[model samples]
Target: MRTDWLGAEFDGVKLRLWVDGALSQRIVAGSPEQVLQTMLADLPVTDRPLLRSGWPDAALTPVPSAVAVAADQGRMPGLSQAAPADLMRHQPGRIRGFLTTRPDFDGVLCLIGHSTVWAHLSAGEVVSFRSFISAELFSMIRSFDALPAPADPADDGFAQALNHAMSRPAGLAADLAGLRAQVTLGQSDKAQAASRLAGLLIGAELAAARPYWLGQEVVVIGDGQWDAHYLAALASQGLSAAQADGVEMARAGLQDLWQMMQAKG
Candidate 1:
């Protein structure tokens, strides 16, 4: 039987199709509803859709055979009606599990999305987690009349600010204030200020996540740009990390769960 999975992240939604134990196709859409609509449009009468809510707000309207991904320690109010009893709030754990399923895997795992950071130990335990107001900040910053556009990934301003934030996590608030001051006085461009603000926020997360990252091997999973920022930040601490595509990991996780269900049946 052909099985399709639809999942949502902070940035967008993704659909993965698996047929007879092989992945056959993948699609990306702007929103969960749009992705689901697309899936339904072409869905065969014999097929059912599986949904995994990555963020807090990713639940589709109830449909027959629609299953949700869940975590053991958390509740996804969005997926409450669609998820199976055996599947629970173990997303962070599942991501870690998928990473470890690879050969010779051992280390700390970091999942950095648009507005959240999840750090997990090699033992499949969550060490630290946080959800920031990144979208809110971006919206607020965009509303400014004179601020420069967001910084490019190649900007030294981003690296420098990220290093500074990691080193002085306690000064985050002060650093943010300084960013505004610099921008207001024309001492720094909008791009530089924006980079510094991001640095400050991520730096704080790195600080809190020190226990998981201090001496462990780390791997990052998420959007390429955000992953790069996190990799650079970790490198600033003299730490090295491997990178994995978040979409692939999400698909792998859903596949793993689906196989589990099939086995039980």
Candidate 2:
């Protein structure tokens, strides 16, 4: 079927996904109707129904028909409105499990399906980043977008790290453990360790996206804490970085970071 976004403007972080809608639907088509309804039990309520979010009252756009078609992952045309007591926890395309912000921002964010502008923040800067293009991530529970989710925020920060770590090699895990230990000990080399960790994690996720990055054949390193500490760690090491080119950013590990950030579930 032809597809559309139901055009709505959400001004925040920007992330991207190339949904193979046909593939997704082919997979979902075989599931029983009750199972599909059960999985998407808590679809979020918004001013916009077509648009679902994990953030509170945030505007949302529904997953394009193409995605529903391709992923075959939702109730699609047969979805029913959720009752107040439904235990189901989200719409298929709804993003984020939590939506939060410091005291100053006007709108709250949802933190489910994908990464958003909020992620690029340094607990300080509110810059717009196109990568993982999202308006924000919220911890709002009881459904924010189409997905009905726990109002309690999900620990996405940790989820992204741990999820990626699980797929990588034991060697890389060992390396990260050692590095983190040194970091906890207040080692002077934490800056360098973090820098290297960043690259390794980036490498691992990117490699995973390749058709050949079989789970048994590859090793990944790093969790995203390094990025959280990036600027401070760089200063600690006395390194002045320059503007990151998109290609280099992807090559330098943003690509893998992208993969991890885009992870499902």
Candidate 3:
């Protein structure tokens, strides 16, 4: 039964498809609409399968607008009602991922991706939340020639920098400038520089988001070195977070949505 449905994910630059337990991916060189149309044309199916869009505002083109799936339409037992229109427009997939995986969690969910979200949940409903673009900033900084790569999360420099940034987020600019000076003076290596940079950014983010997870049972979901950094940083502050696979959470979210639609029908 699972093989009867095709799962497609487009993140602006790439398109990934899963069918019959097989995976296929390609660079989205042309308009997403064209790419999706082409892919659909080649599929060996007769009837049109159910279509699900992560959100109306996704980078993927040709999706139904927000008005199409009104808040009341996607309600479930625990995750009844979609997120606010603005938040839904930005992080629908991540919110869906969290809802599907930890709907009844009574604490906070820290979803790490290009943009990280810290959402407080109680009785399977979102109470309050905040979003951070720290990861995006980290990526942008790492693109510079001075810091061409990120350091391993285990590096001592990373921990020290994280501590420093969390303790005094206001000093971030000076600290960053100091790193540049150290690098220019040949006082720091690339690995140490990168680690410190990442630590500083993440630490500042954690500092700003302290109220969200200060005394809550936290679960972190993501799949990347940045995610590992988040876990390690949280551990540094005496907080332990359970981890879940982001990919699995997303698939589960979509599955839940499908079941909800079937039930409605």
Candidate 4:
């Protein structure tokens, strides 16, 4: 089946296979269901073949995380819907995925992406979480016709602007205007202006998220690209963070859920 479009927008559809409850293989394609169905058609028919679906985090509201409160591990733990009503978007899949790998984790998880999420976890459950749109905001701002293209990776504008924003958040509007003026007046180059814009936005996010990260062990989960920026921002505040692979965490979480399901049956 054709699966080109899957790579066009994002990583193509992901498929995981299990035989007798043991993960066998994983596949990525533009159309995973179609591919899976084709493969299954050639297999010997079985009356009890189990077809489990991947968790769809986007379509569902995030439930406060839960873990087995007892030794059996497969036993269901009571969950509560305690997420604040204002947090419209999040990736609980990532949160669950990370926790499954490190069940004893106790701290704040900063999952950075288009809609970054900061979740507080304690005693093997998610205490609370808040989401921010800093990445999306950066994309939107960078797309303006008058703005410069994104800066080079080594640019110092990001650091300089971040510090400015962290110290003088109230001047954010003026800072933004200054960036445009700098770009328009030929004082700052394209890369410099772009980097500075990113710094300002990220600085604002760090400021708002201070309550989440202050005096807490932070583990940042993300694809490598955006992880560095958030890490740098945290480091500026004298905080150190550990990094984890976001994709792997999600896969592990799903695998854990699959094992739990098999145990119950």
Number of backbone collisions per candidate:
7, 55, 0, 0
| TM-score top scorer | 3
Q: Write the per-residue lDDT of candidate 2 for residues 115-137, one digit (tens) a residue.
A: 31111222222222112211122
For residues 1-265, write the lDDT of model 3, one tens digit per residue: 3455555554434555556656566777767556766776777754534333332334421112221122233321122233432243323444465666555568877877767878777765466667787877777766763575666788899999999999999999899889888988999987789999989999999999999989899988875657789999999989999887765665555555566556667
* TM-score of every model versus the real structure: 0.68, 0.25, 0.80, 0.72
Worst 10 residues of 3 by lDDT: 61-70
Pull out the clashing pairs in model 1. 70-88, 70-89, 70-90, 71-88, 71-89, 71-90, 72-89
Models sorted by TM-score, best on top: 3, 4, 1, 2
Whose TM-score is higher: candidate 1's or candidate 4's?
A: 4
- Give me the overall lDDT of model 4: 0.64
Whichever of 1 and 2 has more lDDT, that candidate is 1
Tens-digit lDDT track for model 4 on 1-265? 3211110011223454444433334455556556655555664434433323332222323445453322123211222344365342224545666887788989999987767878888987777777777777777777873566546434688888998998888898898888888878989876788889878988988888899999999999986767888888898889999999876664555455545555766
Model 2 global lDDT (CA atoms, 0 to 1): 0.26
RMSD of 2: 18.9
TM-score of 2: 0.25
Q: lDDT of each structure?
A: 0.55, 0.26, 0.66, 0.64
> Could you say which candidate leads in lDDT?
3
- Where does candidate 4 clash, by residue pair? none
Q: Scored by Cα lDDT, where does model 1 land?
A: 0.55
lDDT of model 4, residue 249: 62
- Model 2 ranges with Cα > 4 A deviation: 1-50, 53-65, 68-168, 184-189, 212-265
